[model samples]
Each structure stands twice: as structure tokens, then as C-alpha cells.
Target: MSGLTVTLQFSGGAELLFDKVKKREVELPALEKFLPQINKTDWSLRELLVWIKDNLLRERPELFLQGDSVRPGILVLINDSDWELYGELDYKIHNGDTIMFISTLHGG
Candidate 1:
């Protein structure tokens, strides 16, 4: 089966938690690649979040996530628009989509 391809970007110190990767071009595997409990033919940002945490996050998961979504203060943009405009975590993952995570949190 053809894989789903997309672009991922991290910025505003968010990249520090993801091996300092500012951008990535990824090819998501088939449905089997998603969490075992998930059953679907399509991918969503929710699944993408978990996938990123599992495959790309380097450390301190709590800094980036809370429950099933991004911790508060983290801004998510889909194709340059606010993720909230597209149903946030429920937003479907589309090929060539550019998903960006920007951290608005800072530590003293």
C-alpha cells in the first residue's frame, strides 16, 4: 500500500525535545503502523502526535504532551493555519500537509 507522506516542523524551542529537528519529511506506514487499539484507514493529528512521541521525541515527553494531546502553551499549526481551526487533534492527516509545533512555554 502507498504510504501517507507529510512534513513535520518544530520551532520555538520545541525542536529541542525532538532531537533538535526543525523539519522532517515522513512516510507513514499502513494502518498497522498506528496504535493497536486504533482501527481506521485514515490518519489524524491525534495519531500523529502519538507516533511522533514514540518515534521522534528525544526526552521529557511531559514537556510536550498532556494526556492525548499537546500540553497547553504549545501552538499547533496545520498548513500554516491554527490547528484549532480544523478540529485540533481530530484533524485528518493529508498527504503533503505541513504540521508545525511551536512551544510558547519557557523555563526560568
Candidate 2:
């Protein structure tokens, strides 16, 4: 019950790779246990991506992750703002933050 709480949303084709779930509430470990490599006091979106791929992703992970980042054509928004404005993967994930993923590759 004591950890970083955040909301994850998947849209377009992104949800397809996540068991068709559109929204998820995740509780990440404290800063110390989240990702100690970068900063023991914070967790970055980069680490969150890896965590999601390893923990939440139910199938076809490659469709959502590529290398150290999200697959191409997937747009990410953090707290209602484009992640690019906050350094994308480098952005620090805060408690109560909302992260959304939309796959533009989905067919019309």
C-alpha cells in the first residue's frame, strides 16, 4: 500500500498488446527499489518501460517495446503533456502521474 501509484492507459492498437486493457492502475516500488541504476530516489520512464514489458505486458512484447524504448509509431504522453517536452524516456515518474500510450500504427 506504500509505493508510487500511477495510472497507465493504452489506446489505439497499444491496448491489443496488453490483453485489450485500456487503463491500469499500477503501484511501483519505492524510489529505492524501482531503479537504483539511474537514481535511488527516483524512477525514470525508461525504467518504467522495462518494468511494464517485464510485468504488465501479456503477449507480443516486441510490439510494444524495442531495444530500450517503446516501439516506433507509439506516442507517449505524461501527465497530459507530450513526453518529448519532458525528455521522453528520461522523464522522472512521479506518484499519481498518468502515463498514456497510443499506437499510431493501428489500421483505420
Candidate 3:
């Protein structure tokens, strides 16, 4: 089987770390490329994060990624809906899906 292509969007200052490309389509290789331990055919957001960190992220990934997922103040939206509504990092990304990451900065 071929890979899945999805749209990634960065905003609310998240784009700064991604070379200022607000939106881009990425073709994620087969899940086996990332997880060869099992027969999983879907890519989870957690896996996607690792992929972005390795491929797309051009700057400090620490700012955009914390641990295994996005930083605390970064909001994740899947297809215009809150990612929380769809299990956040556990959400299985599909082809053509639009995933957006928005950073929330607090001024002191």
C-alpha cells in the first residue's frame, strides 16, 4: 500500500519553528516505516509528531513539541474540530485530514 497524505497547519506563532510555512501537505510513509513491531496500518498523532520533528520542523522542536506530544499551551485541531473531542494524541490521522497546531502565548 502507498502512504497517506495529510495537510498540516501551523499558526499562533507555531509557524516560526516550521520555516514559516503555515500550511503544507505531507505524505506519511506506511505505518510500518515508523512502527514495524506490529501490523498497524494507521498513523497516530503521536507518531506524526515524531515525523514532523524529524522532517518538517526546521528550528527548535522543543518549542513545538514537549515530550511525546505538543506543548501544554498548543491547541490541536483535527479537521476544524478540537482534537480533544477526538482523543487528542491518540487520534488516528487519515489521508486528506487537516491537522492544525495553534500556540497560545501568555504575556506577563
TM-score, every prediction = 0.94, 0.88, 0.91
Model 1 stretches astray by more than 4 angstroms: none
Q: How do the residues 4-98 of candidate 2 rate in per-residue lDDT, one tens digit apiece?
A: 89999999889988889999999987656656565456778988898898788999888888999999999999998999999999897888999
Better of 1 and 2 by TM-score: 1
lDDT of each: 0.90, 0.87, 0.88
lDDT of 3 by residue, 1-108 (tens): 346899999999999989899999889988887768858778989888988998999988778888999988999999999999999888989889999999996547
C-alpha RMSD (angstroms) for model 3: 1.6
The reply for model 3, stretches above 4 Å from the true place, is 37-39, 106-108
Candidate 1 vs 3: which has more TM-score: 1
Model 3 quality (TM-score)? 0.91
Please give, for residues 14-84, the per-residue lDDT of candidate 1 as tens digits. 99998898999999877555655767768889888888998899999999999999999999999999998
Best-to-worst order by TM-score is 1, 3, 2
How much does candidate 2 score in TM-score?
0.88
How well does model 3 score by local distance difference test? Answer: 0.88
The candidate scoring highest on TM-score is: 1
